[model samples]
Target: MKRKILLSALLLPAVMAFGQQYGGMWIPTELNEKEMKSLGMKISAKDIFNPDKASIKDAVVQFDGGCTAEVISPKGLLLTNHHCGYDNIQSHSTVENDLLTNGFWAKDMNGELPNPGVTVDFITDIKEVTAQILPGTENLTGAELTKKINENIEAYKKAQKTESYQTISVRSMYYGNKFYAYVIETFKDIRLVGAPPSAIGKYGSDTDNWVWPRHTGDFSMFRIYADKNNKPSEYSKDNIPYTPKHFLPISIKDKKEDDFTFVFGFPGRTTEYLPAIAVEKIMTETDPAMIAVRDVALKTLDEKMRVDPATKIKYASKYARVANYWKKWIGEVEGLKKSNAVEKKKQYEQTLISKNPAIKPTIDGLNQKYNEQAPYNLHKAYYSEVVRNSETLTLAGIYSNYIKAYEEGKMDAKNNEALKARLTEVYKDYDAELDAKVTAKILALYANKTPAQFLPKDFGMLKDANKNLGTIENMSKMSVITGRGNLNGIKTSDLNKLFENPKALVANLKKDPLVEMYGSFKSSYFETTDAKVTALQTDIDALQKKFMAQQMETDKDRKFFPDANSTLRVTYGQVKGSEPRDAVSYGYQTHLAGVMEKYVPGDYEFDVPKKLISLYNSKDYGVYKDKTGDVPVNFTATNHTTGGNSGSPALDAYGNLIGLNFDRQWEGTMSDINYDPKLCRNIMVDTKYILFVIDKYADSKWLLNEMKIVK
Candidate 1:
């Protein structure tokens, strides 16, 4: 029988059974080939993972959006999540030149705009540093063990130093029972290459974020220019193409059930090892709370943005950003409860505890800690938003701490140096204009809410936004919002100019009693959060140890791996199809016709420009057709995925990339809660759709000529 759509095998407390299935930093060399093959993988893990074999390295890129990406060219080229690059493309759109609303094309290679903050990560090499670092250690106590391990690592670093990359990350997998050192190559020379119009790119938008039977060409392109030697270097016209060892071959055919496939990328995090009770709390209380808050925020933003054509364009990116993940969270939460993930985990924990009383009390202790911390989370989210709008006292507090430490000469040399470097580096990404707009938007949101629901309670400081904002009692009515208003529908740049009296940053930071209240709140918040986190760490670390202990006993049937601890992790699942929440079954099937179905003629979400609609109307569907059928634009695979899996490379049996995994069909949005092979399928745009858009629609042959396409 196929795995039921069960995120958790059974319900149980997480502190007991939930932390077991978490596989940490699994080396590509270590994926269970035999098991993977049984799950329908045609290629061996070694085939896809071996950097020396075929072009796997060139096929892998760390998708900053969430998943991983790879260089498919010797020239600066990148392939990643369509959703990941969506907002980046939208950011370049504006009133007269709205790329997002009308969609964007460089018209030529030179027209490609340099994206400011986007960065692509390249994995240079990964090594098992166990023997080199943990030569003789075997389960030592917490502090002493950490000290000894660090000392060992420090000596190893000093003795065997070779600098090919800037940050060498050591990830503990199998619950800190094993370790892998990944040396990453980072490049900031990435630029937006091409993207389909929103009609094709974001087709479904809010109506289809995490749902299935999905048809969205969610893909984007970026070019990366390396130094003359093709090594990592700063952006320079003097730089040359980064000739990569491999690039994925474009296929116009769809995948089949049990068809051999693989994916390579940096998956963010997962909690496959959480105990049942903890899962329950999240599914029932925590997820519900987050959903409730996010819904209000998204609805408010959506309603307010539709006020005018200009306002809609101004807030387009903002609305998408808020709604995209808000629906995802809601779906996951709803899916979790429906799939009975929490309950399954609970039962699993009970079974473990019944069999092993030695670990029961400790597990129970962990459960107690999770319960105590859960309630404060809602307040934390609400207040966290408040804190971001206020002059960022968290960073300021840290700075103050650093100053105090420096004055006392008590700061460690390494930490002091790191702090200074980080502070300086942060300013490069800081935009005062964006900040003012975001600050105003959030403050205005709080300012407009009912007094009882007010978060910071204005204290008569915030000029009432109720009078300041454009008032329309019905936001969803859409047509009533006539676009004209004072500060209500004003542009951010215009608002900054209007509020140019003494600058809002310094004004809010130095605003008399408010500043003092903020300082006091910041101090209290820091102290409280620090103490709680510190106390929580003790148990959390203990939980980690317990997780590691179980993982060490994997004796072959299944190697117990620890869940992700905000550290690194590697989860392995074959490319397979699924059926989800609704009776919808996602297949390796998608048609270009669906793209036009997502078009709504001029609605912001459904806007279709005449030139593009002309092409579609001309029945000029390009080479996006599949071998099995014609007009295949998007497809689904039985690949297990989640939030962190975005931008992951879905590959064929030859270890070649097939598609970029982005989201799962809505039915399987609950895939994280329970990976249902029947209903939980990961969705991706066919690689051919990408090529067609680039070569035909966008007409950027320079970028297309770089890729390796196999007909």
Candidate 2:
């Protein structure tokens, strides 16, 4: 048949290399050991991942579901990026004792500070379950196919013999062509060990984030604790430091260009194989629109933070988290355009379709779906950005829970106790004035920019009020959520009044304009836009799965890798730099002198601690200094990485920890979709710099003695 011939042609090109080398989030179990060895990976695949044996994978962990961390000592002394641990650090900081500004060091085990609700998950097993997950469903399509797959996944998980402390979940890989089950043991009692002040940990702060030739120390320390049995347990006085199955030895040897390197960690998400239409939409519409909204938020937060030290302390983590991705979107859009990614994807699609005209219909459907859903996607983004980013709207969301509980007649002593605890936590860090300003600006933008039909009826009806959402004074007075001022001013008595008489609370909320507006938005979003978006996305996913299956079948020899989905993966490359653009060559490494060069006295982002400055000036790097007689601060490598790889270990050829992966060069953030091996480089804080800060700066020699250090 013509279809058969066309499929064969598609398979021919699919198996051939596209010429770019060594940039993939590879599965540790399925790695091509011979090919990896040829690419300068000196260690065997078994050394990287072996469920039954002690390996590097034993030390890597998912930190608080958002970042990665590695065990550096037998006592489970954990190392992660300062930014990854920023929230925990900020949680412990106050204006009077400002741990964030001045840093903290635990002189001994007893001094380690416990972080409530923080968890570290270690993978105990990963198995390919595609054979079990996809059977009895290959002939099905659309919702039925998804339903069957999910049911199979549930059955698989239910069958696993897991402990109370262990959690197992299944994730689809290669766009649902394969399923992987990961067995994870999560430790709930992760504690902070030490960190440099924000000045050292976040040198150049937002200004130098995601840039190359960097000097940010960007490292923080934590310790995982367990009960005497060395099993997962909550924080307790009797809990002791956990002894990990394996831990990485910190290396003091100098790194050079082309020296073998690799990174292992969980990466959040990637759409590397999206059709050209989706890529175009991201670059042209979605990213720019979201970026604009976040820019407004960042500006407001930054201005307020600069003026008030308490506000700065309160919003530092929030501001940094928001600004990080906002800036990244700007860079991603620019990079996608500069790389001609959309056009390249189009060309690749054309080539594949030309070879296999049988797939033309599938490709057409995918493109049409993307084009149709573009506007809705953008509207959904605007809604989330406006409502979720504004504290007023987010707080309103909480009140909706109260309203729901009232309607369901579920309010009781136990529930009220839980509600009180939630309110207390929310109010502790809540800033009324800052959030009010943000609410005004965010609401105005949403009112003007979001599609009229997508806007809540109440919000849309009031759009004629000078194109603004009215004064904060009027809005707050009408809001039960804001408590006639803001959430912090809300009292226990106020909630008690609501819980005492659910009917009275319902009547009150029904009359409250802000509460009614929140209800309208919530109902409209789920009833209309959310439902529509979900249906369209389901169609898109089905089409994508078809295309992915084809690619997998055809490209049997291409060494295809799965896209990142917050699952553990190994990426290997070398210590290298790039000329991102013409006349802008960057080197592989940076040193203490560069840190001094960037230092600015009394500056928030660039201020160096006087003691650190003195040590740098005296060249007192001690045993941590590289062969160049200068302490290395940070370096770049060609290893492909993304957001969740933050705090992942950058290992040398011999499996020693040499650096901690923290960021990527700004020009290469688009590597998540379009990896150009020459331009894409991961930034890491040199482990030696971490050692210097701990041993020399913090005078934590006792802690250094715990680590297994290598020359």
Q: Show the lowest summed lDDT stretch of 10 residues, model 2.
A: 1-10
After superposition, candidate 2 runs with Cα above 4 Å error: 1-22, 32-35, 87-99, 113-118, 157-167, 186-191, 225-243, 300-318, 413-441, 451-473, 476-480, 483-506
Estimate the TM-score for candidate 2: 0.87
lDDT of 1 at 610: 70
For residues 1-711, write the lDDT of model 1, one tens digit per residue. Answer: 121221111221222211123223344666655655654556555556555655365457765535566666656577766667877877888889877656666665566677766666766566788787676567676687778878877776666555564567676665556666766667766777777777677776766666555667777777776777777776766766567766666655555545655556565555666666667776676566545545555555555455646556665555665666567767777667666787776676566656555657656776887777654544454445545432323344444555456557665657755765655443333333333334334445433432432234332343454532222211111210111212334322332342243233333334323234455545644555545655665666668567446534432345444343332233444444444435533345565555566666666555565755676677666566555334556666555566666767677766556677777766556655465454456777777777767776777787767766766
Query: TM-score for each prediction?
Result: 0.74, 0.87
List the global CA lDDT of all models: 0.57, 0.82
**Structure candidate 2, residue pairs in collision:** none
Model 2, span 645-664: residue lDDT tens: 99999999889999999999
